[model samples]
Target: MISAKFRVQLPEGIWVADTSRAFPDATFRLLSGLRIGEKAVELGEVIADDPQAIIDRPQSSIDGWELLEATDERALTKYETTDIELYEFVESSALTVEFPVVVRDGWYEFDLTGTRDDLERFGDALDEAGQPYELQSIVGTTDPESLLTDRQRELLDAALQAGYFEVPRDCTLAELAETLGVDKSTASTVLRTGEAKLVAWFLTGPKQN
Candidate 1:
């Protein structure tokens, strides 16, 4: 559920855009055929069941984070392999997306030209998994009035109504602050406090069991 902007620099004539498009399907196949944590590496359209196999022959790139392999695919592919411990971080790190970004005016701006599909899938997967984002507001057992200040609730509700969570997500903190008629820091603080309270209420002070 994390919202981020990124830019990637690819080598000339790599057709990486097409690769990314076909990737989801290929990845789907790789996952359904394997077990969790098993490594799968891609060389052109050919994906291997071995991580060491591909790491030994990484493709040349201008400057970008290669998709390599997502953990879910690895785990699904692991069903075909005997070694399972090799893919320990598959659940957390592999499934996670790291978009390369250029800092512009203190905000991360994404390059959506070539890898739009991948970014889309990344965002979708996160939403399905229920992760973090720029304007994430969790539903908690605690009543809104009991957990957050009146102003905090008001701003969050406004942000939600303003499509803050929609992709391409909108509403920068400064912009939202202007809309809410508050200083940027105050807006950020209120949102953070509200989120913290919601999380605390939802988790009920963490598990003792």
Candidate 2:
């Protein structure tokens, strides 16, 4: 299985998008949702200073909206909407959506898990529909260690432990080589080759063969 992360700019005039843009400081989480005939019903939570004001405001694309609960900084709501294009696409593609679709800065960010083919098809469909989206990453479920040799894994672990990969690196190439008792050239070659393999596996998948 593969898990793909996506960030989609919600179309203008949608309630959630408009509200999020209006209150950029607030966070809106679409916890769960389902389609009911031509309408889509969703349950969500809003984290804001004035949740009641948001609940009272009028919005487009919504047939019904109700605030189920509210506190000083949070609100729970149930709403039914007519803007179902994105919802329909997700349902028809047979991909499983992770909950709590985050809404901020007029964008909906979420993860969808499925086979590679299904995810590719879904992305294509979104493009055909002219929806604006960004594919952040596609991560395979397989363990990354399975793709590396024992030596590669050992070097990587040592590098990590020595803070070689840190923002302000604590260990230099010479130090790393000394720790492994290897010549500088051999250590550099092994580290570079291993890094390339890991990058390839992350962007695509494990090499076949």
Candidate 3:
């Protein structure tokens, strides 16, 4: 995965309004020891990108900020309009906010680059809160089939042979479970988890494009 520091400068006007609508009375809050009014609030996410960026604020803080009140029209303009004084303040402003962005390394990564098969496998892993395997995690194991567990191997084998992964639809999960001599829930869990791990394995060890 590729990792880098990401810093965004938002005009106070834009920042306050976005935060206000996103949060309520408590919006635009500053750090405890910092002067509250001088600094602007920001919201961001570390997403997969050509040049990755990271968001560092805690989830609880994000939730708190989101609860603040809406921004009036005046506040919105502070960040929107280019005021010389505001610009100076922004430039000389002691405000410093920093976060890290990590981009996952994988096959031909671009915005929305993953194939259907890749997305299905990777998305499930993301849902499970699994940190991506470092880029090149599976350099030696080139075959997708080699990365899975026995059950996962069975599931994928069945899905392919029986066309479960097909668009028109193939054998149901229940059918696969019966054929594998496992309970439906057990088989489903294994298949899903295995799929996620398989995707994680596909990405090279963490390195940026």
TM-scores, all candidates, are 0.30, 0.63, 0.30
Q: Residue 165: error of model 2 in Å?
A: 44
Candidate 1 vs candidate 2: which has greater TM-score?
A: 2
| Candidate achieving the largest TM-score | 2
Off by over 4 Å in 1: 1-144, 205-209
Name the lDDT value of residue 140 in candidate 2.
71
Per-residue lDDT of 1-209 in model 1, one digit per residue for the tens? Answer: 12223322222223233333334223212111123343333221123354333333333432222343344223211212322221232233233211221221122223121123434564564465554333222222224355556876898898788777568758777888898888564566567656645554454433346
Model 2 — which ten-residue stretch has the worst lDDT? 199-208
Better of 1 and 3 by lDDT: 1
Candidate maximizing lDDT = 2
Candidate 1 lDDT trough over 10 residues, lowest sum: 97-106
Estimate the overall C-alpha local distance difference test score of candidate 2. 0.78
Candidate 3: which stretches are off by over 4 Å?
Answer: 1-143, 204-209
- Model 3, 108-193: lDDT tens digits are 11111123444344445434543232232222334556555586687777768887788877788888788878756456555765
Q: RMSD, each candidate, Å?
A: 18.7, 14.7, 18.6
Clashes of each: 14, 0, 22
List lDDT for all candidates, in order. 0.39, 0.78, 0.37
